[model samples]
Target: MRMTTNANRRVTDEQIERARSIDLVQFLQQYEPPGELKRIGQSWTLKSHDSMRISADGRWNWFSQNKGGGDAIGFLQAVHGMSFQDAVRTLAGEDFKTIPTTQAEHKAKPPERAAFALPPKNNGNRRVFAYLHRSRGIAAEIINHCIKNDLLYEDAQHHNAVFVGKDENHNARYAFLRGTLTASHFRQEATGSDKSYGFFLRGSGKTLFVCEAAIDALSIATLRKFDGLDWKKDNYLALGGVTASESKLPAALERTLNTFSFKRVVLCFDNDAAGQTAARRIFTMLRQQFSENLEVQTCVPKVKDFNDQLCVKLQNGKNSPSRGTRESTLSR
Candidate 1:
């Protein structure tokens, strides 16, 4: 049966109902090109020239443009320039030939550039260095090394520890900010931060150490230093926390594997439920994705995380010249 509709033809109640019942996300997944759609939290963001986001409830809004959302039909009308009759017919599985053209249109456009920007920088990372070196038990030399290399800093506005992730071109593509205050849980990604470029400490070793936060990564480096190992010779990466969603590996790890050669991939996430779950998921994923030549292993922190473990070790008069000394004495 051929379904034909003119602009003047009225869509039946059954047609409208059927179109509305179609799952918008599933429909887009089936029809849209890969990487054009991204799920952030409970909402789905359409990666267009103007950044449009659609909620799970079928409402959408374009941030860069002056546009609000509507039903699935409205989505087609707004985004694809489809008329009401065509939108409904498309949703009802009657007009499927245009999907190829729509996908091609999206693909022909230029890729989205990383409009990454860091927050205001202070005169010096005094508070951040103190927080990491004193409170977080990270070595001062490690903090200084990162600061000198433009990989970390303190935001002038809120004294937040800003960990920067750079691209292969040495451009800042991601910034993960955490408050310096000991009691604060304030942390956020800078606007337009790209997760594919994660904050990392480059090393010469074949083994890659992964952590849940920048502080944990630094803590691991500190631990490596105390063990008399050349800390800078080992790769350290913070994943910005592990993802629970059963998708492919996070952009950071995937990007690393593609860009750098590595034999051993270590999962050094926190020793908690979420971290453990993420480690297991990543372990299985890496094993399946790579051949047996790649060694995927999980090395959970002795405590909650590397930072906590470092603090406990330091307090217990371990690997320190003096007992109960909280401040880092490593030459900066």
Candidate 2:
């Protein structure tokens, strides 16, 4: 079982079963700890049966166990001393070109640094800002494509987070912090990497554009809000994943609401089957809230969402039958 580092590490599942089939004495004494297995991340101590210990041969050490298991990523962090990016690559056992770390770099553990929480300064975590900002840039084309269709943006109130081209400054505007999903659904998505259902429609205002989920709202605004189209300058809203319902939002957010000339609210949820049902329910509820006829129209994506349409544009030649309501179930 004890193999040299230069020796190829051939580990067959069968070999493991063979070892396991052996008696405790045979395993503890004769079985070697084949090619040096380096510990990753923190030490892992475990319980075993029948005096099962590898023949140390000056190379084996039992890792003292811990009650809590580290994250899989964390485990790699301890073993190879890798940074987050590098650790990702090492575990994958392949070149992750989206990163710069080589195998050696990944194996090296990151140095400890002081952890501190600074208040909201102008330069709050430039690294995080840069990453998210870049995501916005990559997302811009998709945004523009949406605008070209039929959506619109409210200009005046977008000062907090400015818009490009129309506003001149690169800023993020308002933050609509509501979801149709229960607080629990919103919490799960917010904590995870896929923060799609979000809209930061910053602007000064009264009228609003409301949708069922964050993704639909943001896409409607970013892709076409400024398309000089029919976007009625209402503050956009995404009711998380649910159509607007009897959900209560913080009064502070509601107090900030303003619209242009107070146009009727547009209930633009997805055009999916669920969206159709939700839109009908929302329209009935909202019509009662205002004296004006609240126009609750549903906007369905030709493909999935605006992003899917953008990808189709990118993949097929832009001039091909790839653009617009031509083949989508949306135009109807």
TM-scores of all predicted structures: 0.65, 0.35
What does the lDDT read for residue 29 in candidate 1? Answer: 63
lDDT of 2 by residue, 154-204 (tens): 223211121111111322222222112222111111111111223334334
lDDT of 1 by residue, 147-194 (tens): 999999999889999999998888898888888899876766676777
Model 2 stretches with alpha carbons more than 4 Å out: 1-200, 203-207, 225-234, 243-261, 313-332
lDDT of candidate 2 at residue 154, scale 0 to 100: 20
Best by lDDT: 1
Evaluated at residue 125, the lDDT of candidate 1 is: 87
TM-score of 2: 0.35
